[model samples]
Structure formats: structure tokens, C-alpha cells
Target: MDQKTILVAFGGASPEHEVSVITSHQAIAALQESNYSITPLYLTKNGRWLTGETLLDLKNFEDLKKLEDSCTPCTFGQNEFGQPVLLEQKTGFFSKPKTTPIFAVIDGFHGSKGENGAFQGACEMFNIPCTGSGVMGSAIGMDKVMAKTICRANEIPVAESVDFFEPDWVDHQSTLITKIESLEYPVIVKPVHLGSSIGVEVVMNQESLIRAVEAAFKYDDHLLVETVITPLMEINCSVLGSSRAQRTSVCERPIGKEELLSFQDKYLNDAEAKGMASADREIPAKIPDELTKAIQETSVKVFKLLSCSGLARLDFLVNEETHQFYFNEINTIPGSFSFYLWKESGISFTDLLLELIDIAVEDQNQKARRIQSYDTNLLSQKAVKGIKGLKSKK
Candidate 1:
């Protein structure tokens, strides 16, 4: 059978770069056995795109710099027929670069420009099929403040939050602090655009809040401070498909050692580095059946609300005592694609990935069916002739 090349793109210029590598390798391992031809598009931490057979091995990731040196630098280019292809850059004087046609792009990236819609927009520009949300969904999902705002508008339960930018804090630090404190002490401060709990902190007083905010600013200029739910149980559910149809996996309650799950708690605990799969979580979350159902329903709701597609894991903050769950955030490109959660629903990691690819292909086919460009010549010669009569604002 003729094989379509599926490009697994990962490792971005983000704080979660290492986790992204692990996620990509896991995906590569699974997709290798599929009918498609798997190609690795490794994005270096410095924002360079490279690809090679060596990138398929997880062990090669131990020395990122050395690994990068062995790969061929590549970028998205169009074929003579205007189809997107992974074009390798010129290496040596006599080197003949090869182009690999990209049938679909598996978004293995975790954060920053990768998860925040920059990469998705690039795929859109090239008319490439990308697994995960489109530009709007990815952008909104990356912003905690925006996600919460949408939840709040939709009457979805969410913790009371006060969000501000660096300049806002600089201008009115005391006022912002006062507003945060009003939500009461023991509040959680988080970098608005970060994940893996990198710049998240729970503080009981003004001093700790100040320090947390200052530190979080390093990860993101925008910050969100919200009341911390005491006896909080973090429940996460993975959603599949787009607005046309949707499904949610069994709920999983993450077991974090600290006040909240940290980057170390999520990825570094395992000697093998299994990404989010190795992290401790109670599958089918031992919560009440009704609560599980509620979370499952909410997960799909949030997924549709944010315009997410392909796959996403929605995390909810549940009050252990009251069992009142609040929409926390959505991971558009969840680690390991949250295959572990789907596995509980009778879906294997490989099957989960295959389904995601199927969804992406269907979405692309539907997109192609739409009327893309109007035939009207808005920029005809007559329009260009009038440009000289217009005055400059300056």
C-alpha cells in the first residue's frame, strides 16, 4: 500500500521542552508500526527544526545538543503542486536535500509558541492537517485567564481569580495585592500561559504571594491569583473529537505530593521518564459515580466551549469536602495525548493516536470542502490605480 508520511513534531522553545521530547518519542514508537510512514520533526529548544532517523530513539534525547548536530535541518515548504512538504535545508556543498511530503502533523509540542497556536498557524498557512486544535482553540486554551473568563461567562464553576500583567502590577502592586487578598489567604498564583505547574505556587500570606508573583513573572508576564481550594482533589478528563461529535474518557484524580502538582511530580518521578503516564493518578477516579459523570459531561462541554478538536485533557479543581468541581484549565496538546486515561476506556495508546490522526484527516477533508477564496478581483489594476490619490496619515 502507498504510505502517507505523518510528521511527529515536538521539542519547542518552551519551559516544558524536555517533556515534549518524551511525548514525541512515545508517539514515534507507537506510530512506527502503523500503516503510515512516521517522520520526526524535532524542534530544538532554540527554535530550530531538524529531522533524522536518530531522533526516533528516546536514548538519543539524553544529549540534546549532540542529537541536534546529527539531524538534518528542515522547514515547511510547498511542492511544485503547492502541497506542503518537509523540505530539508542544504547541508554540504554536494548534498542533495530531500523533501518529505507531510500528510498530517502530530502536534507533540507542550507549551509556549508550540501549544499557543504559532505552530498551528504555520500548519494552517501551509494547509497541513494538524492533530489538535486550530489556531483559535490553541491560542485561547494556552491563556489561563482567557479560559477562565469563558468558563465564568458560561456559568461553569471556577475559582475566583484576579489576573494582571507585569505593567499592571508595576503600576498598582498594592491594589492588585489587595484584590487578590480579598479572595482570602491561601491563594494559588500561576503564570497565565504556562503548564506542568512550572510557575504555580500556593501562598497563605501577602509575603509569599508577592514572592510567588515575582517568580511566576519569569515564566509569563501575565499572572493569575485565585483562592486555593482546601482539601482539593484535582480531577482530569480527556476529551476526544470536535464540536460535531465528542467523547470523554474516565476521570482520573492526580496524586500530587505537594500543595499542587509540580513539574517534577508530573514527569521526573519515573526513572524511565514516561511523561504524564508515569505520574500517579487514580484511574476512573474513585469519586462518586454521579461526580464522575458530571466531570465527564463538563469535560466535553469545556472542550466544545474552547473549540478544541483532535484531543485534549481538561483538568478540574474539585473541593474534596463539598465535591464542588471548578474548571481549571485545558491542555490542547496534552502530554502523551493522555493515552493513559483513554486506555481505561478500552483504548490503547496506539489506537488513541490512530483515532486522533483519523479525526485530523476528517477535519482537513471538511476544510477542503469549504469555499476557500472568492473569485472577485479586489486588487485589480483599477484598484491599484487609485492608491496614489490616498494621503499618508503622517
Candidate 2:
């Protein structure tokens, strides 16, 4: 059989764009020796989709202007065989667009539309397999309030939070502040639609809370203030497979340099920007066996509960002394694919990628097996005649 084309899709209009690029590059490198041909689908920060051989090289990204000028613009389309393809739009006096059949897409995005179901929805529209969660799962995973509300309803522990849109804040700042302050002091303010702690801030006083909220508004219009878990120790567990069947990897305890894991703390530790693998963390976290087991079990529960497929990393906030934990959030397309945790679980990076691809293919196959559309011709001559009669009557 011929080698399949795996489109490594990444980058988006989000604060975590660089982190997404790093994750995609890491995935590309791991899949280099696999039985598949890799294609780069680099979505620029300004929202242009471009792809080329140059995009496959990380060095080319050093000067984005030069890189953008050299890459070919591309879009999704159907080929002669009606197969989904990545059609390259070449600009020239005598140039024809080239189409490459896309067997599947490796979604390595971290935030914004790329990870919030928009890109996944596009793939669904084209009837192609895309790795990671589907539209509903991705949307819920990216929304902090919705995810937490679902968890809370499922008897899963979650911190109390008050969410408000920009307009709500503009019109009812005092009322919102009163509601948030009810969660008590030292609450954490976060942008609802972002991940990687891009706009997360731990606040104490009302003055500091207002300042943080104003600052976070720059990143997102939807904001939430949640009760902070004091003496917090963050634990994250990765779940693989789908709702039908799945397993959780060994839990990891991330070591933040400050109060909470900030964007810089997660992605800026290494000079080479080695993605989440370079972040400070303790694998198979030294927590009690019971705590670890609880986290692992809860991770799988949340994954299946949210209808997540392929893989997801669920983070939990723990009260170090009490050993109590609360589900924080789920990252559908986790940074570095949460491969570091999986690595410690005895699964290699390449194997993890392969497993994700297999899950996506299985999902697509399952969908194909179902009735996609009605076979009858609704626009038959008889139906047309009836329509003509209605028009004649009118």
C-alpha cells in the first residue's frame, strides 16, 4: 500500500501560537520515520493558511515575514476522485494548483479557533479524519465555565466560579465583583476561551482583582473568577482512546515557579523552546498512591464524560495538606500532546501519535458505516410537477 499523507496542522490566531508551532514541530520530528508522508498546514497568526516544504523546517520560522513570502497558500478541496485534498494555490502567470489527498490531519493546535472546534468542524465539513476531540468535545474543553459546570453536575469536584462577558462587566461591574467576591478573597481570574495560562492571574484584594480582570480582558472577552485552591499543587493526567474504551497515563505534578502555572512557566523554560517536555514537572507524581489513583481514574471519567477522543490532558488543583482535589480543566489538544507523561507511562512519542491516528481513522470508519444521506431523489420530475402546480396556484 502507498504511504498515507498526515497533515500536521498547527498555529492559530491565539496567544499560544508559538507553543502550538513547537508542538507541531515536535510531532513532525517524531513521525519522521513512520510509514506516512507528512504535510504542514501552518495557519498564520493573521489567519492565512499556508503550506510548503519550507514550513516543515523550524529554522525557516525565525523570520516569519520571509517564511510567509516563501510558503504557498492552501485550502481544503475535493480532488478528481472526490477525495478530500489540500489544494495548493500557487501564484504565477503559468501555474496550476496542486492537490494532495489528506488521509488525516494531526491537530497540534493549543488555543483559539484551531483548538476550539472551528478547525475540527472544517475537517468534518470536508468529511476527513482529524485527530483530537470532535466539535462538541473541543468546544466544551475550551470553555472553562462550561467544562466546570458539566463536571460539577457529574459529581466531579470543581471550584466555584462566576463567568461574565465583556458587556456584562461593562454594565454590571459592581454586581459581578460582588458575586465573585462571594467566592472569597484570593480568587484566580482567567480568560474563559484561552489555555496555557495566557491570561490567568491570582488576585487577593479587590483592587488587584479589578486590575487582573482588566488585564485579562485584552486576551478574551469572556472572563471567570474562580475560588483558588490554597496550598495548591497541580496534578495533570493524560487520557488516551475514546468513550468506548480508554486508559489514563501516570499522573504528573507540574512545578510552577510561582503561585500558578503561568504561560511563561509552561513554555519559556528552555532556550530552544522544547514545548511542554521542557517544562518543570515530576512524573508519576510523588503524591500518595491513593491520590494518584483517584486522579488517574477521574481523568478517564472526565474524558469519557466529555465524549473526548484520541487523547486529552486533564489538570487538577489539589489542596496539599487536605489532599482534596478539584478538576480544573481539560485540554483537548494538550501542549506537547502531553507526551512527557505518556513517555513515563512506557508509551513512546511515535507510538502515541500512531495511536491517535488509529483512533481518528476508526472514528471516521465508524461514521462511514452509518447512513450519511437519503438515497431517494427528492427533486424528481413528479416532485417538480407538484412544485410547478403550487407556483401556478400562487
Candidate 3:
């Protein structure tokens, strides 16, 4: 039996570039002991797709320019048998290019085109099995406003807030501020399309809110300001499998130094390794069993509501005193694939990756089973004659 090649795709033109790299490395490490052959599909910060065995090492990333120079440029294309292949483009005029059959793709991206549905759409176009949410789900998951709106319409609890574009913030600062202030002071401001808390801030007054919004606009054109869950308790839970059949992992109460978990707190501090898995958290979240069950149930609901697949980590903000929780955001390609949560749920990292790959294969098979095209030639003589007068009539 031939070992299947899993393309672990990661990195992107995203603010969370480093975080994505860490995630890809962690996944590669886990898959090393497996029977599958791993191929590193590393997308550079400027958006070039490269692949090579060197990219599989975490240390090479210390100097990104050198690392990018070392890898081979590659892309997805079909082989002679119409099977998907990772085609490594030739570097020299006389050099023959190489091709590697891609069995499936493990999405290790965090933000931007990598996680915002673009990369997933590429995989769909190639008919390659891709792990994680589909195009629509990934796009919605990346946009904070869209996710909240969908959740609200589905009767899922979410915080009330106002969202605006950069032009609105610049042209009508006072008006936007008024709308945001309506959410009240000490609200949390976040970049609408970013993750890893890249441009998230908690503001106490109008002045600080203005400053935070100005700063966040640097990362994204759109911004969301919502009422902060004071006496905040951040609970996270991971969900696995496709929308049709999924299960939730154990909940985690991420312990942060401040009300909001800063990027440094989550990834930077003590992050010589262990991407998101490095974050301080109480696994199985010491909350009551009933609350945990409710959270788990809600997590699964939102997972299906967003049409998420493979795996996702849903974060919730709970009002500690009231014991009320509201959906915050969903990480479709969550850092480290949220395997830590699954670990607490009794699934090892290797098992989790294998399950995700299996789900992707199953999804692709299901799609293949459908009637994708008809046998009719629309431009045939009879069909052309039938439509000849239609255009003129219309």
C-alpha cells in the first residue's frame, strides 16, 4: 500500500503569519509518526506558495527571507490521471519540475485569504479534499459581524454591537463614536476580519475608545465594538466532524492577566513553542457540569449554524455574576487546531489530525456522489436553434 501525501497548508499574507507557522510546525510534528507522507505547503507573508522539506522545520523560520529563498515554488494541478498533484515549478530553464500526489489538505492557516475562504475555494476548484469549513463557512467565520448576525438570526445569544468601515470612522468619527458609545463604556473593540486578538482592545472611556478604534483600523477596514462581558469569564470549546455529524470537545477557561486575552498572553509569553496550546487554561473548565453541558451544546449548534466542518474552536464570553454566556467568535482554522481541547476530551493530537483528514476525504466523496454536470451540449445545433430567437425577443 502506498502512503498518502497530506499537504499541510499554512502561512499567509496575514497579521497572524508567525502564529500560523507555529501551528503548521506543531501539526507536522504530530503527523511525523503517522503512516502518511507529509508535504509542507508554506505560503509566505507576501503570498507566494512554496513547498520543501526545509519548510517542515521550525528553526528555519527564524530568518524568513532565507527560508523563503530555500523552498520550491509550487501550486495545485491535476496529474495525467486527473488526480490532484502539488506541482513544484521549475527554478532553472533546463530543470524539470516535480509533482507530488496530494491525498488531502490540512488547513493550518489563521487569517486573511488562507482562512477567509479563498484557499478553501482553490481546493474546491481543484476537487481536492480540504480539511476545515467550506468556502461560505470560512468567509462567515472570518468576518466578526457576519458570524454574530448569523448567530443572532438563529436565536443564538450574541453581544450587541456596532460595526463600521474605515471610511465611516474617518469621515464621521463623532457619529460612529456615538453609535459605539451606545454599547456603553469599557466595550471591547476588535478588527472585524482578524483573529488571535491582533487588534482587539478594551476601552474604558470615549477617548480610549477613539484611540483603540484608530489603532484597530490599521489592521482592518471594518471594526466591531461591543459591550464587554464584565467580570468576564472566557470559555472555549472545540468541535470536530462535519456539520451533519459533529461532537464537542471539553471546555476550557483560558486564564488571562487582563479582561481581554492579549496576543502576547496567548502566544508570545512562554511561546518558544506550543502556539495556542501554550495559553494558560483550565482544561475541562472547572465550571459546573450543567453549564459545561450547555456550553458544549451551544458550541455544536453554532458549529452547524455556520456550516463548519472538520474542526473549529468556538470562544464564548460569560458574565461570571449572571452566569450568562454569549458567542464571541469562531476560529475555523484555529491555532494548533485546538488539539489541546481535544486532548482533554481524550483524543490525542495524531488521532485528531487523522480524524480531520478522514472527514475531509468523506466530504469530498459525498460531493463526488452528486450530479455535478449534465451530458447535454448547450451549444449543439438543436439547442442553439431553440435559443436563437430568445435573445432578440428578450
Q: Name the top lDDT candidate.
A: 2
- Report backbone clashes per prediction: 0, 0, 0
lDDT of each: 0.91, 0.93, 0.92
Give me the displacement of residue 122 in model 2, in angstroms.
0.9
Could you tell which candidate, 1 or 3, scores higher by lDDT?
Answer: 3
Q: Which regions of candidate 1 are displaced past 4 Å?
A: 92-96, 391-394
Badly placed stretches (over 4 Å) of model 2 are 91-94, 376-394
TM-score of each candidate?
0.97, 0.96, 0.96
Task: Write model 2 residue lDDT over 1-394, tens digit each, in one string.
Answer: 8789999999989899999999999999999999999999999999999999999999888999999999999999999899999999967879888999999999999899999999999999998999999999999999989889889989999988899999999999999999999999999999999998988899989999999999999999999899999899999999999867999999999998885997787888888859998889988799999999999899988998888999999999999999999999999999999999889989999999999999998998888999988878769999999999999997
Off by over 4 Å in 3: 91-95, 382-394
Displacement of the residue 303 alpha carbon in candidate 3, Å: 0.5
RMSD of each: 1.6, 1.7, 1.8
Worst 10 residues of 1 by lDDT: 385-394
